[model samples]
Target: LVSYKRHLEIMGERNSYSKTDLDATFMRMKEDAMNNGQTKPGYNVQIATENQFITNYGIYWRPTDWGTMIPFLDSFRERYGTQSNEVVADSGYGNEANYAYMESNGIEAYVKYNMFHAETKRRYANNGFLVQNMYYNASEDYYVCPMGQHMERCGKQHSVSDLGYRSEVDVYRAVNCKGCPLRGMCYSSVIDRRSIKVNHRSDSFKKHARELLTSERGMMLRSSRPIEPEAVFGDIKFNHGFRRFRLKSNRKVRIEFGLVALAHNLRKYSAILSKRMMGRNHAYATI
Candidate 1:
């Protein structure tokens, strides 16, 4: 997570950030791990962008990325009047609350999920169930528990993203699996119940992502990303020689990064203007 604070922006000179604001924001982000609660240094950068232009910008030193998204998105909306329909980000941005926010606000997002999560991993007991037991009913959009139980949505709050129903899918456990014929290969655990939390939110997005990833437009949109954001980062680090940050606090770091981005934009804009002028001059010479 990266951030620069509002106070930093307010106190900083044209090119530098306020030291006090940077320390405060960094402390906020690192509050959990740094229990002692001294100034834990960190930073976050926010950029409002279109297909080829950055409209608004901000930075802060915050530890977690979770709290910053909505505030940044809202700030972007306030400045730019709205945003792209589909927000594309990597798995680090994936969270239940963020998904709910997207769904509620009518914005679609393409966020990756960690594969090891229970939602994606299907558990199987060697002695208990056959391959058929793990089958997902596409028509029904539900899973069959190992014990031949139909796991329906339990009318309970299972998690933070409780859409008012929890996945009530549990395995059909016969009380006497020890004496049952297929006990050995069916389950390894003493407790025969084989039902767990299935994240439907992640599942739904994965379906949406699959459809979009295969489309021609999706391919084109994805292809452009490496060139755009990566180019900006590369130029800042390599061309501009900004590998290590000179500033310690989040606020100063943000101010510095903002300047770097601004510089890149200005250079690109200047290059475009120069090319146009050169073209006009060449045309005159030809005439």
Candidate 2:
């Protein structure tokens, strides 16, 4: 009991920690060697790229990428003393809090939210049971369910994320759903009335993001996102064979990765310089 208590004290708020590296978290490793999805001690690294160059980066202990976006951007701003005019990322980094941050900071967000692609499909849009598909009376602040029952806003539910971001969702309940035949199809609540939670602010953010992400410039930028960050990761993992970190602790790993980022940028510059030199040599030869 004493040994377990000591270990728990050392772990703190984290679920698991590596004894070898106190700062390292035991997270599920992406590359499961035996295909059993084994856990390994590692850190989640977030990076922003502009034209294939690493503009900013942050090391986070959080396994989920959604919560990392805000902190990563904050670090980028602190380092550069300015925020980027526009940001583009995958659905994993999209959330209400992240969108709000970008909006308040005046950064144009071309980020995709969860189920963004799925929501664009015909089935998703045509589904009557979906809260999004239901008729919403903005003037009265109420929703008309698929059964034509008025769902009035009852109250608000407030919750906080693990990262300490507070958000509120409005709860709407139908007047009576006891006799409705579609009650089973809509909600499975034990109560007679059907209730649903909706965050109008989040919905507004998502709507705006959809517009930005679907634009011509946004499409061009989105198409190149994979080539930017993913390509760099591929080069680091496959081409450069930098799969495992030689450093033990998070602070040491950060410094090690800093060198890696610098090296990648230097290699790109060298390649560009070599190409220019070759072009000059060809021009002189032709002359």
Candidate 3:
């Protein structure tokens, strides 16, 4: 990761947007992933196609897809040095940051967030909760429970599920969740308050999150990501038997993914070739 960043001349300090710091953070994550045997803080390789060939592609190592838009565009620009004119991505990459980046970079981007869904609503209803049912209180810098319960930030150590590193965190819990009227909908614990665990160094994260959530384009972009990325994955994993990782290490994984992408392009090209052979003015040709 460090070598790639240096070679690309992409990781660097910025006046308004420090690309170096961002790259450094991503590199750290990659290192962490390598050490821990996880994909967290990793880069994703994307291949764009037209007429069954990879017209453009890139590797983005940002923590979230939202941040990848600008970097992807920048990388594309660096590679082709030409404007795509129009771009399309999923909701994960659709936030204000990405849209603004697209607009600034002279690319018209289409991205959608997964804002509303009947299935999601139904599931939440079953659980008696809704999206953002749990949220952080910025003014007080604490987490607010679903049932309007405020959990004060307690300087305590607690083990959170899914966090690879065992670290201390600020714990917040509903003061009187046990006796609260909304207990049924809020907590399954009677003896303890509704605890909301947060990392100690979470200010920047919180800010970025708010920016992603508040933007209209963010939501829109998220919606497109699932469709586009899912389609890409489905073609690779389901159709091409790429469900298992064929190689170890980031470099090998990249090569393997590239080959899979190459295969996909070849298939697409074959279809086009077959159509062209049929006739220029024929129905197959049109297809």
Put down candidate 3 lDDT per residue, 220-274, tens digits, no spaces.
6555555665676677767877765445545666676777777777887788888
Q: Measured by TM-score, how close is model 2 to the native structure?
A: 0.95
Please give each candidate's TM-score.
Answer: 0.63, 0.95, 0.44
- State residue 15's C-alpha deviation in candidate 1, in Å: 29
lDDT of 2 by residue, 1-287 (tens): 99999989988878889888988888897755667778888899888887788888778777789988988888988998998999999999889999999999999999999979999899999889999999999999999998898999999999998878899999999999988989888988899998889999999999999999989998999899999999988988889988888998778999999999999999988999999999999999999
What does the lDDT read for residue 156 in candidate 2?
96
Off by over 4 Å in 2: 1-5
Q: Give the poorly placed runs of model 1, Cα more than 4 Å off.
A: 1-40, 48-53, 64-67, 116-142, 145-157, 160-188, 244-255, 280-287
**Could you tell which candidate, 1 or 2, scores higher by lDDT?**
2
Q: Which numbered prediction scores highest in lDDT against the true structure?
A: 2
Q: How far is candidate 3 from the true structure (C-alpha RMSD, Å)?
A: 11.3
Q: Given candidate 2, what's the lDDT at residue 27?
A: 89
- Candidate 1, 130-237: lDDT as tens digits: 433365676755556455555443433334322232232223223334454455665677765433344555566565654664467666666776665556666666
Residue pairs whose backbone atoms clash in candidate 2: none
Angstrom error of the Cα, residue 201, model 3: value is 26
